[model samples]
Target: MSGPKEELGEQRDSTKKKKKKKKKTESGKKRREKQQEEEGVKGGGGGEEEEEEEGEKQQVEEEEVHSSDCIVLRGIFKLGKKSHDVLLTRTRLTWTPITPEMPTGEACVLQPGVMPLQDVFAVKVKRRRAAGQESGGPVLGVTLFCSRQRGRRLEEDTLHLHNASAEHTYTWYNTLKELVSGFSSRPKCLKVFINPSSHKKEAVHIYREHVAPLFKMADVSTDITVTEKKGHALSVMKECKLDEFDGVVCVGGDGSVAEVCHALVLRAQLDADSPEKPVKPVLPLGIIPAGSTNVVSCSVHGVRDPVTAALHIILGHQQQVDMCSFSSLGQLVCFGFSAMFGFGGQSLARAEKKRWMPSSQRREYALVKTLARLKPEYCHLSFIPVTKTTRDLFGHHSEDEDLDQDPGSVDAEGEGTWTTIKGLYLNISVMSIPCLSPHAPRGLAPNTSLANGSASLIAVGNTSRSEFIKHLKRYSSSSGQFSFSFVETHTVTAVRIRPRSQRSWSEEESEGEEGDSKTTPIIQTEGATFPWNIDGELVEIANEVLIRVHPRLITLYGEDMDEAESTVSCSCI
Candidate 1:
């Protein structure tokens, strides 16, 4: 047996060992938990940092590839009167000095010059050799015809860039040619109508000589139809598959052009009226100006040059023009650029009677005869004014803007806005376009616009022969012709004309005294009808006629007339 002191010492030693082991186990568990928490935080943070770094690297690589993809060509170029180092890009041609003049301190540096590819019209390459050194070396030149703006005027300008070697020139030329060729949306195929009887009777010859070659060069395929009889082109247009062709070209005078335009408009309207199909828009019209008076062509092109009109068509340049519809008794008589009654109608009527004579001699004879028999006719005219708000808001707006607006909003019926005038009028002329021609350079209605949805009503009240002659002479002079007190002009959306006298013709009756017998004989009179000069054709219209303008009903191939150029009043006549 052991003593009491020994037993107490053993118990205390065992308790001390147990306490130390428990403390060690708790410390180990805490250390494991701390390590696990630290690892979780570091792993999540590391993954996000790696992803961010990878994204940054990818963005930098993409930027490098984009920069490398841009092809650059550098050369010296002369644009107009200035010379600069040119850098050609895919979308633009930039010019900068080879050695730029550095600005002092914080001053702004010279801006790099830029010309968008859209402005370029044509590009050509030419080779030249030094005098007496032709065999050894050739200098090559690249030329570009581009549309440029100077102040408010837009003009076509030429740029020439010279290179020492032919290889460089050819490379630049090919590049620019490819670029410019892409800018044109010209049609691949066209349906052409040629009126053989139009002025000079050279429409077919003009098409073969001047117009066809250009179309061939532009890679345009044409389906041509030479009209043999009146209304032949109109019949073809109405029956043809319009969707198969990209555009239609009319090679004729204003009459033929008008026929084609009317057919297209009528066809489109006819399609719209059908319940089975959607509306089809009219195809663009290109006029070659092969007529006696190409007023539409001259007005749109600012000149009656056939080649210019052809080039405009080939380049796919287009403009919108208003169309006038003349109707009598709810029947569309015709579509015209300009219309005339009274003296103008008389002149046309007289001219028609002398069609057996040569064109020149007939015109002269008709003018003399009409002037000798000049007399005012009593008539009533009513018109609705184009509201000032509509004119100001939509005058400069484009055809697309007009379409975007509610086209049906305009009320053609006079409603309460009709202004009536009853008087003896020497002449009444209504013009949609300016009606510019070789004879009338400033146009009969000089202030009118092609797509302004308005027409100019020029009324010449009763005046003396000498005074009217003076007014007519002004058309040939540099001074304008519309300043007379007897002349009145107004912009209108619609017009109605009615002659006061219905007794233009009468029947003779003879009564016998024996019984109630009577005999009535119809009298045939030469001047029994009122003639209307529509477009350039004359028609006998004895009753009321209503004329209205359809805004941008047709598209013409040309540039929009510049405000200054249009208003300048050309001296061609």
Candidate 2:
């Protein structure tokens, strides 16, 4: 509606207004960019408002990791110590300050340029393989460094970290990779619980004075607790925090070893969040023989050397073994070896009864006393097997019933109802090691492995007085050259024994029967109380006793002896 000149002036004025508005918008954008840059620079140490905002972000991230957390660690960390290996599986690393919030009391991930990490043990990492690359997976070695914090307790500070030495870092990387892909994890440190009352009442002193130094040499740290009484070791194991240790070792006989296995397995069953859910304890255990008959250790490691065993602990050598539990006289009892019932039973009892005597007196008395009891003039016995369904309760057999089924034939039992004679002797010999009799060529079960899920059963089934006397002489040869003519070896799931009354003379009756060579008739299969012997210990039981074998329940460490003696200079060194 305006003239041309007036319209041009109005349009120019409008363009000026638009330019002003554009300048203001550009200024606003510049201000926002500057503010954002400043915030990012000071985000870690800004004012309270900014700190609160940043803290919220970190919290959300940590909550995500904690939801699925699985790994934990706790141990001493000092400068310049040998680097120990920690094998991990299916876990991720999350940095946390050494505080209550951190399940594992590890100080922090060491950082480069913070502190001198020259002394801490080197780190080795390895990874398990993937489905396609099973053989050549991930492996890395790391040399962890520590951060510098003046006067700050490792437990209180958040830390920075860096890669370890080149070689160490590579090894650790590889190891960690392997572990995360595998089924088991081994920590860097272990807590050791040793039983001092196993074989003799001197296990504690023996381990401390002789074995502790060896473990130290192998760079293994241990917190030893000497058991005060029977089953004391098991109680400690049940109560201790097992996740903190890499493994556990026992320094006693098979009895002490059995206690540890039972405790671990039982606790695993009770734990709601157990890794091996609804299954047995996969925690590896070690043993050092301090017992008189260390069959378990001898069987697994082939030696009795404490030092060698300690080395194995540090090395983290592992193998799966089987364990068996049984009930005797309504009491649950676990044995690493077979339960002896016949002459083996009576002999064990005699040996224990004469224990208070002098060593020489004990041996002499046990031999003479058991010889007198071998006469068939006092007791009758029978053997019975537990049914398959009932045996499942306290058994370690595989799920396949065929593998656990008793392999012996039933046809032989009917022909030998009663072993009538003037003397009765039995041996419940079970062998896990190659050499059951030292200084002799005889072994209980030479073909079995330590982890095999079966046991060998050997018995002495002779009743002739003269033959008994002859067999007794063979034991004195130091070679255990027994007359094998009358012995029997049968593999069965279990055996039960019931004994009957035998004729006894009141000294005068014995005098009359001394010259009499007459044989006695067999008794009927009726109910009668009989004295049964278990591993040389005697206990009177109702006519039947049941026994079963456990193949491999634990790991043992001993001297590196061989099946055939080799002329290697044998020294504790």
Candidate 3:
């Protein structure tokens, strides 16, 4: 046994060792905290895209939000064997490599990688799984998945943040979960309608292979309905408890998507118990183009790709869109985005009669056949115009076009003058969206915004057949087809077009048998019925239709982009 002096000396030396170790640990922690306080993370330098708020334009400057106030939690994390300083900010998750200062006075540079919070749809825990085990094992780190724009399309990228401490691993996971799940616009539950008879009849495969996996990765719950018949999607949507989902998604063509949209509008009216006053749908709609004609998807998203559409939905990209209410004979026909009368209606009508032929071939045949028998229709047109923007040539504006307030009443301020005309017209169109496609790259209504409080009423006056073909060919341009003297374009809020009786024809044509009527189709049926193409779906309504433009009545998943670079042209002509 040692003496009391020796024991006291050993105790003092052990106490000194403990103090030194504690001082070193606390100094390293304080150093990290000071670095975080002084040098906050840098952001990705890309310019922020504009966000459409309600119906107004607003810049979101998603990159300018990085500051001390924006930092949520940060620490040292590892990427492979190298260490990195990681930060979770209010708007971004950024990381930079950590390199110690050299003793030789050499300079070192740090480059950080960043991902905006809006683009990061999911964060999951990485675990090491034993053989034949799918559930639990030793904890690894965290994995974050981001959807970003690559060239003309959106692509998915991943980042693995390797950390060994299980407590910190869970702490980062919980923080990210609370932050990402707190986005009010991000859909947590979805009601999806899949049309089995889409373009190639591959809607199921597209969803399972391309769309559903992303939804699963994002932890979004879904209720999917596979449509069986022509109106199956509409019927199913009508009966569905819509409030149970965050949004509605339709995987189909423009026509099917249009039908789904109409169903949603009608459902809203039914729920509101007021069909007379058109009500906006509470849920935003997502369109996955799996069809031959994807006008709505192409026009809104600038591309007709399913993967891009799905990613937009996952990332919560949303914009308001205007809608049209077509009321004829004191009855609401349906709601749509676009409508066509006269020659445009005639082409679609002929195409409908030849459904046995393939879709492309049938359209070509209808175009050729309609051109063979092209004739002018006598009509009276009336419109209430909206004020023109700088981009528009002729715009008539109304002072009482508030989206939240009822658009039924007109205000005394800047009330538009009602314009009326009676003439022989070749074609007429009412469009709220630009109706962009590969054939019409600049859109059929190039000057129109997706949520502008007006619609474009394009009226083609009577012209020679060759001249009319030239006007039709102009759709494949970077502007609206308004070059001809016969083409009249007006930005209007309300339009009433009535087809006049053709006194030039005999009563035998009107009182003829069904076979004769079918063989010799009337150019414009007077008061009895008239063919109109509403969002690619053919609708026949008698007398006149009152088409009123409702601004920001529906929400869609997309952003505003420049007119698509059209590479395809119409060979049907």
Tell me the TM-score of each prediction against the true structure: 0.66, 0.50, 0.78
lDDT of 3 by residue, 1-573 (tens): 579989999988986896677677876756766776678844322222222252243223443433523889998888888999998987778888998878897758877888778888899999999889989887889988888787557888888999878899999999988888878888999999998887678888989999999999999999999987877877887789988999999999888888888898888988999867778899999999888768888877888788889988888889899999988877777788999998887688777776668878888888887788788777777777675322125442212111122235453434555566777777889999988887787788876879988999888878789988988888887654787667778889888898885442224334632333464332233444667888887776567888989898889988765565466675877
Compared with the true structure, all predictions reach lDDT values of 0.71, 0.46, 0.79
Highest TM-score against the true fold, candidate: 3
Model 2, TM vs. native: 0.50
Report the CA-based lDDT of candidate 1 relative to the real structure. 0.71
Q: In candidate 1, which residue pairs get closer than 3 Å at backbone N, Cα or C atoms, i.e. clash?
A: none
Number of backbone collisions per candidate, in order? 0, 69, 5
Off by over 4 Å in 3: 1-69, 100-103, 130-132, 388-416, 501-528
Candidate 3, residue 307: Cα displacement in angstroms equals 1.7
Q: Looking at model 3, report the run of 10 residues with the lowest lDDT sum.
A: 396-405
